[model samples]
Target: MLKEFTIQTPSEGFVTITKQVAQIVEQCHGEKRLCHVFVPHTTAGVTINENADPDVVKDMLLALNHMVPDLAYQHGEGNSPAHVKASLVGSSVSVPIVNGTLYLGTWQGIYFCEFDGPRQRKFCVNIL
Candidate 1:
């Protein structure tokens, strides 16, 4: 089975979407399946990481900014760096589900990366 949804990000940063994914899993009502989440965008990505600490996300963004400084890119759109960063991070995350729960590490979380400004983004969820 497959389900898709859209989320609006406020700005260029990470937005935790664990609850939303969890809700979808609950709605699935299946015994066991692989949950695949995919984002289709050049300037956006998805990842599994620590959401318990805000600083973790902050430091990550900071580090990424340091690595790929905003002013370093010469793309006309001014968002070429975002596309690069998204590519580096990736555009999807797949998690295993068992007993109706996601099998993730203790501090792991689902994050939606928004490199561009506030916009509507879509994600696909496939239970297989």
Candidate 2:
């Protein structure tokens, strides 16, 4: 099964979508399955990380920006850092679905990493 949703990111940061994805999984009838969440944007990505603390997300973004600071790049769009960060963060995440629920850790949550945003984004959830 497949589901898609849109999100509007206010700025560059991690937006938790764990609940949304879990809701989709809950609607599925399967007991055991693999849930694949994908971001189909070149300048954005997906990940699973500590959702209990907002600082974790802040630190991650800070580290990424420090590592890939915005500077002159060949990409004329001026979002080369976003592309690099997206590649490092990855475009998708897979979670195990058991008993029709996402098998995530206590502090883990799914995040949509927006590097170049304050814009509309779309992500897809595929259960198999």
Candidate 3:
């Protein structure tokens, strides 16, 4: 099953969507399965990372910004850095679903990485 969700993201930061993903996973019935979370935006992506410490998110964004410097690109849009970051981070994450729950580590959580402006974004969840 595939479901879409909307989220308002910051100009450039990570938004923890663990709870929302979990809620979606809970709806599936029977046996162990797999869950895929996908972000449908060029400047956005999804990842599974440490969410217990807020600084982790900040550090990740800082590192990404540092790595993807604001340099001229062939693309007319000035959001080349965002596109690079999104490519580096990837657009989807897969997690194991056991007993209708996400089987993530204690500190691991699902995050939506937004590298562009504060805009409305859409992500999808697929249960298989």
Error of 1 at 63 (Å): 0.9
User: lDDT value for candidate 3?
Assistant: 0.92
Model 2, span 11-122: residue lDDT tens? 7999999989998998897899999999999999999999998999999999999999767799988889999999999999999998878999999999999999899999
Instruction: Name the TM-score of candidate 3.
Output: 0.97
User: Mind giving the per-residue lDDT tens digits that candidate 1 earns over 7-120?
Assistant: 999768999988888888888887788888899888999989998899999888888778777676677888887888898889999999988988888999999988886999
Instruction: Please state every model's RMSD to the true fold in angstroms.
Output: 1.5, 0.8, 0.8
Highest lDDT model number? 2
Candidate 3 — number of clashing residue pairs?
Answer: 0
Q: How far is candidate 2 from the true structure (C-alpha RMSD, Å)?
A: 0.8
Better of 1 and 2 by lDDT: 2
The lDDT, on a scale of 0 to 1, for candidate 1 is: 0.86
TM-score of each: 0.91, 0.97, 0.97
RMSD to native, candidate 1: 1.5
Ranking by lDDT: 2, 3, 1
Q: What is the C-alpha lDDT of each candidate?
A: 0.86, 0.94, 0.92
